[model samples]
Target: MIEERGRVLSVEPGAVWVETVRSSTCGNCAAKAGCGQELLQRLGSGGSRGFVRALTDRQWQVGDEVVIGVPEDALVRGALWVYMMPLLALFVVALSAQALGGSEPQVILAALAGLAFGFVLVRWHALRASRDPRLTPQVMGAAGFSGVPLTNL
Candidate 1:
């Protein structure tokens, strides 16, 4: 399970709205000094808040800290859907355009079009996935406040 710490914003009948900060484990790496992620982290340190709708059977209150967990496989699948689809679409469309004897410039244009189309398809699929209960993250349990703080809410 991939776990994250978040603060409960509100509690509903079957779920809680949690506000989490954006953080990456790469922040603790010795090589983070030279990592692009570290640079982006520094750049994003203005502290943005992201909200999660976590399904849970436990009671929660405002300001209560919690640990939410999602399956690692789900995250991997989501990452592939968001990143790989456009790349594969570009290559496939470009090759198909070439097979049809399109000019070099036309092939490039076709690839660009394919990339855009893939993004649209991914966006629609993401919307559908968000409504699927099985895909949503779940509240694992309360978290202690003694851990290292990444960012403040």
Candidate 2:
């Protein structure tokens, strides 16, 4: 599980909205001085907060500190779906068009069309995956606790 500490922002039935600060390891990195990402991070607003609605069985109050988590496999699957599918679609369609003796402009248009189709498929998959509990983040436990699940609190 990938976990992060967050503060409860609001509560609804079976769910809590939590806000977590975005953090980076730049401060501890040995190559920070030579990294472009470190420079960009310095230029950008540091530690911006992101809000997420995490599923939970227990009631939580606003301002309560908690830990939230999602499974690592879910993240890997999501990354593949979001990145690989479009590129595969583009290549397959473009190559098919070329094999069929399509003109350069036609092959380019076909590749673009394939890429758009891939995005549409990804959107559909996301909508479906949003309802899958395995893909959703959950409130793991209250912050500062050790090895205790939130349901016990």
Candidate 3:
């Protein structure tokens, strides 16, 4: 289980939203710095990220510590493919059309269109999946502690 501790912001019969605290270590990572994620992290005014998850055995209060898990299959199958396939498909379609079509500007435009299409497809799929009940994530377990409950100070 991919578990992180967060506080319950809301709860329903099937789900609870726990807000996870993202740490400075997020920006301190070498990969994040190189990827420009550090600058993106700095733009956030909040310390936590809210995750709406399906509830299992866990009892929750507004401030209770709850564990959230995004299944490995879901991570690999849903999130990974949703983004990766689009990009890969973009490049493949673009490069193949360029190589086979024999037109430079057309190839370039095809590639740009592919890239844009890939990004948009990922976002579209993500939104669609989140709205579907079959795709909802499961709850892991619960904890007693909240995040430093994710404070600005």
Candidate 4:
């Protein structure tokens, strides 16, 4: 299980809302001083708060600290769905368009169209997958100790 500690923002029946800040990995990288990522992190750090809703039976109150966990495999699968699928779709469509003997300009337009279609499909899939319990984070318990920072995904 991948776990992170956060403070409870709110509580509702069978669910709790927790806010987590994304810690920048750039801080540990040698190239951070010269990296665009470091600049962006400085500029947008406050915008990194992500509100996560996790299902739990234990009673929780506002401002209470808690630990949330999600399966590591679920995180990996989610990454593949978000990144790989779109690239695969783009290549498949572009190759198919080329196989159909399209001209250069036509092929370029076809590739752009394919990319847009891939993004649309990703959005559709995300909406459906949000309801999957296996993919959702769970409230493990009250946060009694500090844990590693959570990813913003």
Candidate 5:
């Protein structure tokens, strides 16, 4: 499980919206310049806060601290879909165009088209996955009550 500590922003019947700070280890790393996330952080708003709607049965109030987790496999699958799929599409299309004796410009255009299609596919997959309960993060427990069960709260 990948876990992070967050503070509750709001509460509903069976879920809570928690805001977590995006913590990074970039400051200690040597390859900060080569990392895309580091570049995005520098160019973007750099607002470290992120929100998660975590499912939980326990009663929680705004400002409460809690722990949230998602399965590791979920992260791995998501990465593959978001990265590998587009690269694979580009290579396949480029190779196919070359083998078919397409002109240089035609092959380049085909590769770009393939890349765009891959992004569209990814967007569709994301929309469908948004409704999958298995991919949703869950509240592990309230923070600072390691010895107590949440059910007793």
Candidate 6:
């Protein structure tokens, strides 16, 4: 589980909404230059974000440091989709080409097609994975370290 400190923006019967604090790692990511996510994070000229996650047990109030997570399993599953799919595609294409005596151009096209399809599938899966309730971070306790002072409601 990955943890980040966020401030609670709201609370309901079964969940809490938190405004996430932007991290330096986010700014350092190689894809930050082109991703819409980095652009959104840059909003407020570089400050916090409105990140809402549902919590099952725990009461939160405004100005609290609630920890959130990018669950381990979700991370692993997503990696396989993004990293393994293209390689599998390339392998399948190469084997099929050898069997059919296809031209080099045709074989390369198959690899490229696989790359495109893999990228699309990975992106889709990531979006869905993010919404899983079990994957979210929960409030452990309280701290007086920084940002908003922690509180319970």
Best by TM-score: 2
Model 4, stretches more than 4 Å misplaced? Answer: 44-47, 147-153
Candidate 5 lDDT for residue 138: 94
What clash pairs does model 3 have? none
Per-residue lDDT of 146 in model 3: 50
| Deviation (Å) of 26 in candidate 2 | 2.2
Q: Which ten residues in a row have the lowest lDDT in candidate 1?
A: 144-153
TM-score of every model versus the real structure: 0.85, 0.88, 0.66, 0.85, 0.82, 0.60
Clashes per model (N, Cα, C within 3 A): 0, 0, 0, 0, 0, 1
* lDDT (C-alpha) at residue 37 in model 2: 71
**Ranking of all predicted structures according to TM-score, beginning with the best and ending with the worst:** 2, 1, 4, 5, 3, 6
Residue by residue across 1-153, what tens digits does model 4's lDDT show?
998778788889999999876567887899999988898888986347778999899999888878899999988887888898778878888888899999888888888888888888889989998999888999999777444533322
Error of 2 at 35 (Å): 4.5
lDDT of 5 by residue, 1-153 (tens): 999888898999889999887756677789998997677777764546898999998999898889999999999999999998888888899889999999999999999988988888889888998888789999999787666433322
* Superposition TM-score, candidate 5 onto the true structure: 0.82
Task: For candidate 6, write residues 1-153 as lDDT tens digits.
Answer: 756666777887777787775544566689888787677666754554547664747677877666766668867766788799767867776678767987888877877776776677677877886777665556555444875544422
Model 4 Cα shift for residue 76 (angstroms): 1.3
Runs of candidate 6 exceeding 4 Å displacement = 25-54, 127-132, 144-153
Task: Say what the RMSD of model 3 is.
Answer: 4.0
User: Where does candidate 2 stray beyond 4 Å?
Assistant: 29-36, 145-153
Q: What is the C-alpha lDDT of each candidate?
A: 0.88, 0.89, 0.68, 0.83, 0.85, 0.68
